[model samples]
Target: MAIIKAVNSKSSIGTAINYVSKKEKTEEKLISGIDCNPITAIDEMKATKELYDKKDGRQYSHFIQSFNPKDTLSPEKAHKIGKEFIRNNDKFKGHEILLTTHKDKKHIHNHFIINSVNYETGRKFHTTKYEYQAMKDKSNELSKDHGLTVPEKTKEKGKITSFNQNKYRVMERHFKGTARSYVIDTALAVKKAQGKSTSREDFIKEMKDQGYSTNWTDTRKHVTFINNETGKRVRLANLEKTFNDSNFTKGGLTDEFEQTLGRRERSRGTKSIDSRNKGVKRAYEELHQGTDGQGLNQPPSSLKRDSGDRRGKQKGTRANDFDIGRAKEHIRKSASENARSLGELSKPDARTRKIEQEKARELERANRRELERRIERNKSRNRENTR
Candidate 1:
């Protein structure tokens, strides 16, 4: 929902920068009753002005606004997003970008004023119509990332086109695909309107009236039909070309062709989340059973647990003092038995004892031999040190 309007200024880059900043601050104060943090200031302007001296620091002005996505016109959000937009676009690097909020409307809308000169190159930064549209797309993207409510596609303005209901129906019925309908209708309409044989000028006028456009091909050999709103174009065959080449018709109706013929509708149109919520609740009821018009007839299971009487009765199966003492005594006796098993009282019987003693003796002998080897090594080290 964000809108972009660029202004070409005939002022110094320093003057333009200061003017834009002041305008932004004034608008922000009027709308939000607060001063903006004022991102991208005059010093940045001086740095930029230094780069493209021949461009005279400012030959053009760019006004950029990033509108609030949730409402498309929130003043606070507009101010915030607009600043971010300039901060990101490299074209605004050396130029002054003034971001402002407009408060005179029900929805928040903001504006950006930018100087067109590039500090590195004296050339102007060129922004096309598509780039402006892209700015709106980017605004929506930032809104979604911030967890703000995004307006459904249905609420957006569809691309503009000339074809209306009657024309669309005529094209749909007569043409095998979209192509035949548009080409045939256009041809037949031109033929029927001939003032006994209309002149080319008259034919072009009639086509324009019918919401068709005319543009010449590069060689000026072929005529093209266009949709004014979307700027989509389609090439039409001259009478001679149509008759001379059979394959010319084989191109069929492409998406581009249909669009030029105004056969396209915006796909973004979708119900907003708030509007869909109520319908979802109603749909849920018809699919589920055991419900009164008001609510469930029986109390839910959770309510039964909170009734109190059952819980009180369940708590009565408690252990007595005698039972507790006996349990402790049982645990102590088991621990005592485990201790004896690991000590003198639980030593193995004769044959098993003899095997363990033999194993221990062999281990001791191995240890003593290793100790004697260590002592011999130490004696050899002492003799070397004495020498």
Candidate 2:
């Protein structure tokens, strides 16, 4: 699992670049590198960017891509994924990017310093929610391709803290052993309360009596419980699936417990009857048998009636009927139309293609002029040497 975050820093571009491209965190300057001009380094990149965009906004956007600690990913692999993630984004393309992997923490994470302006076009890269989501999607895709665990995708808006930050926060609060242990203790308390309560309100009251406050209001989706002692709160759904509201309703637990007891009693009774009437051919007949008298192998009459009704309805339906000839003609027409549409969409616009071609011609002509100038300079130098 990879967690990607874009932090728009208020500091200068040089400061942000120096922070991410530090040599100490990157194994004494072994793998820390940049994707900008080979001739110029971070300073020159920053200078060029400042010369182009003199806006009073964020200097650079810092992106942190962290992988799960449990994943056996080396620093090189993580850095490669981070670089690929930056390159894949259309906004980050043609811009100077410096990245380094930090091994200071338990997990391997990459810090990227992206220049706000594109060196070629001088257009600023605007960060948006769509861009963040695309980065996350690309990270997960790369993680899966590398046989790593994919994190659960959440639709919740706003900034999400990293896994380590949340863990440290919970620990800093001085909660019992861990959050999981607290959840287990709370679940046991809820179970004990369910045994004595006859209604949902009574169950909640029982829990409150045991120093746990619940937030099972109509507005809240999950049943959240707060421990009065530790002042820690956790949603019941996060503890376990069975602790959810659907399964932990009033009288629901008691009814399930009773049904389990009834099944045990029936099994014991069946064994006793079998032991006493071993000589009889239909020893199980005395039990409540179905039409086949084979115990529970056959379903009850009501279930059989429901199944028959469903089968009858399915047999009478004509939704599956179709004309093969007409269907073939329709499929051919649809296929032809889709192919034509795809071809038209795949082709570049004529006007844009013409402009790109003209730009390429201008670049070639400029390169020839520069080559001729260099040759003239060299010839003049040779004549001066002969003199």
Best by TM-score: 2
- Which stretches of model 2 miss by more than 4 angstroms? 28-34, 37-40, 53-55, 154-387
Cα displacement (angstroms), candidate 2, residue 85, comes to 1.3
Clashing pairs in 1: 62-114, 63-112, 64-112, 73-108, 74-108, 153-268, 154-269, 154-270, 175-181
Q: Each candidate: what lDDT?
A: 0.47, 0.62
Steric overlap count per candidate? 9, 0
Q: After superposition, how far is residue 197 of candidate 2 from its true place, in Å?
A: 45
* Candidate 2 overall lDDT versus native: 0.62
Query: Candidate 1 on 1-387: residue-level lDDT in tens?
Result: 444434444566546545544553446342210111134334443434434343343354545443333453445656666666666665456444445566654555565555454433546765544664565566667666655444332121222111133443544444434344445444544343332222345546766776777664346756676756556555655421332211122121121233333422333224355458778876554333222222222256634653645646654321111344445787999999888767754456755887889999898677656644543454355345435
lDDT of 1: 0.47
